[model samples]
Target: MALLAPPKDWYHPAAGAERLWIGIALVWCFVMSLMMPYWHFRGKQNANGTTYTVTPKDYLERTEKFVAANKVGDLNGIPIVQPAPGTDIYLLGRMWNWYPVLKLQKGETYRLHISSMDLQHGFSLQPVNMNFQVVPGYDHVLTLTPTSSGEFTIVCNEFCGIGHSTMIGKMLVE
Candidate 1:
């Protein structure tokens, strides 16, 4: 049979409980909307600040220079930049890899500068519970202070290419 009927008043009335639930839901939405700014200014939760523009070429050059100056070791043909505490750390993610694994000291805050060279990537620092989006034109500065010393894996949560599953990096905190 045809899935049609003669047009009638299509308005569906709300039950008493449904009306009460709708009012409660609207109040919750308003509360959540207000909580965002409250947390942003007082939560001390994330390192996300005003975004900035970054050119891939310039970022690559900067990363190379930083790696060259701060090289302390290498892993899988990638130079490891172990900058001293209080120094800014730069890391690049492109194609399917996070370049120049970082080494930081425990209990010291680091201004970790992260950006993408090709496409958007996700920077997930495991065992420390920090993750952020790495965009091509924006530098995401993550203020990190390692509580314990260990080797943390940098796993990309965003899909980029066929090699996304194999895109893994490491960071040593000591």
Candidate 2:
């Protein structure tokens, strides 16, 4: 005996629904692609400004207060003066290494304050993420935001001398 088959229309239910889903998906992808480049360009422009310096104690204190008050903490474990939005920062130091390892969330924005203590050294991030010059007596600030969450290595761009490559740092973003 032959088996009976279900109705042809029943097997293909809601043909319009498939079209609607595809349309929605396309629109979403288009919007995201457009926004991603726009955000990246805007962030790059913002990162080209100056940054200020603050004492490490003051930086920690302000960060604590920001946490207590439910405000955002943008301090990156550096004793650099805070920069106003859209402004670059300049920090000065000698053979100093920033502590407390910075942690940034996805989409978070930051302006870096970098300087040297004793000799002329370099500050460079691995994977060629961003570029900044760390010179003695002169602080350089670069604005940056990690769009993705992961671990990145920070390497000295300048070749001061021996142990320059060993001067490594780490950045974490969630």
Candidate 3:
């Protein structure tokens, strides 16, 4: 019965144990808050954060040109492009698919340009686990080097529409 009842005085300083726990919780929260900024500035796993404003029409034209110029073959009606070692690679995210599968060489660094033509999308590179947001009207560039050689799948993690499940794409690193 005594335990169920409130403290005799409704207003009173917290006990020593309660104060200690409160202090520990506050310190923990402060440390967690500081870690966010520290990781944002010094983290190695972060994206390059390079983006540029672009219209969907302009980006589509540029990507189409890139695909036409560097296309080596075709796979399931999609062009398979093999760009030179130092050139930029364009990837377009449209309604239900990623355009023009990319073939990259292992150990070579290339700038990958990603953008969405219709709505916002998520670019998730499987096996590597690299993810980036693909928004319309903006071009996001990621500089990456393929460390291994095999077929890597690019899955859309964002739900755009009914066909989002079929939005899987591919990258061939040789």
Candidate 4:
């Protein structure tokens, strides 16, 4: 029997390169699709929803109740209680020194419910982690969490007045 050679076109470098590029593009698309829902839900705004407000006293009382009922000491004083994991929380409060002073576990998640208490103020976290504006009569809710253990500082991002630089808070994650 005579030996036979493969077709020259079978080893064409250009065709091989084209196939590699197509495979990469498909993989990129697949990854983006898998991430779509997370981005969509995170960016979605709660329009036409009621805004809830609570006094510091009311917040403390609610925290106590949550802790007592759940037998969990994880409850802290925000206008809203601890959110279900991966859920957002809407909170309202005036700008003041150390407003939130929030505490959370290492892997816990949180959505900040923030607003001006008396005047327009700024909300900033350091080591430059999160930044937002706190304006009176307007509500701002920021979805965030402390992924690492340590104390992160929250400073005023806006220049409300002389106290702008002095306004600071702490987010402690254990």
Angstrom error of the Cα, residue 75, model 3: value is 2.0
- Model 1: runs farther than 4 Å from truth? 1-19
lDDT per residue for candidate 4 within 1-174, as digits (tens), equals 136776656555446878899889999999999776766678543222334554555544544454344332332343213335565533333445644345566666665566665677766778845566666655555656566787777777777667667666666667
Better structure of 1 and 4 per lDDT: 1
The alpha-carbon lDDT assigned to residue 122 of candidate 1 equals 88
**Model 4, which residues run further than 4 Å from truth?**
1-95
Q: Which candidate is the best by lDDT?
A: 3
TM-score of each: 0.78, 0.48, 0.80, 0.50
lDDT for predicted candidate 2 compared with the true structure:
0.55
Better of 1 and 4 by TM-score: 1
Ranking by lDDT: 3, 1, 4, 2
Query: How big is the RMSD of model 2?
Result: 15.3
lDDT of 3 by residue, 43-154 (tens): 6555765899999999999999999899999878889999998789999998889998999999998899999999898999999988999999999998878888999999
Local accuracy of candidate 2 as per-residue lDDT tens digits, 1-174: 147775666555446889799889999999999986787787454445564454544544544443344323433543222233343323332333433345555675666566665566666666756666765444456666667777766776677667666666666667
Lowest summed lDDT across 10 adjacent residues in model 2 is found at: 80-89
In the predicted model 3, the residue pairs found to clash are none
Model 2 misplacement above 4 A: 1-47, 51-100
Residue 81 shift from truth in candidate 4, angstroms = 9.5
Taken over the whole model, the C-alpha lDDT of each candidate is 0.86, 0.55, 0.91, 0.57
Tens digit of lDDT per residue, candidate 1, span 63-132? 8999999998889988888898888889999988899989888889888888999988988889776778
Question: What CA RMSD would you report for each candidate?
Answer: 3.5, 15.3, 3.3, 12.6
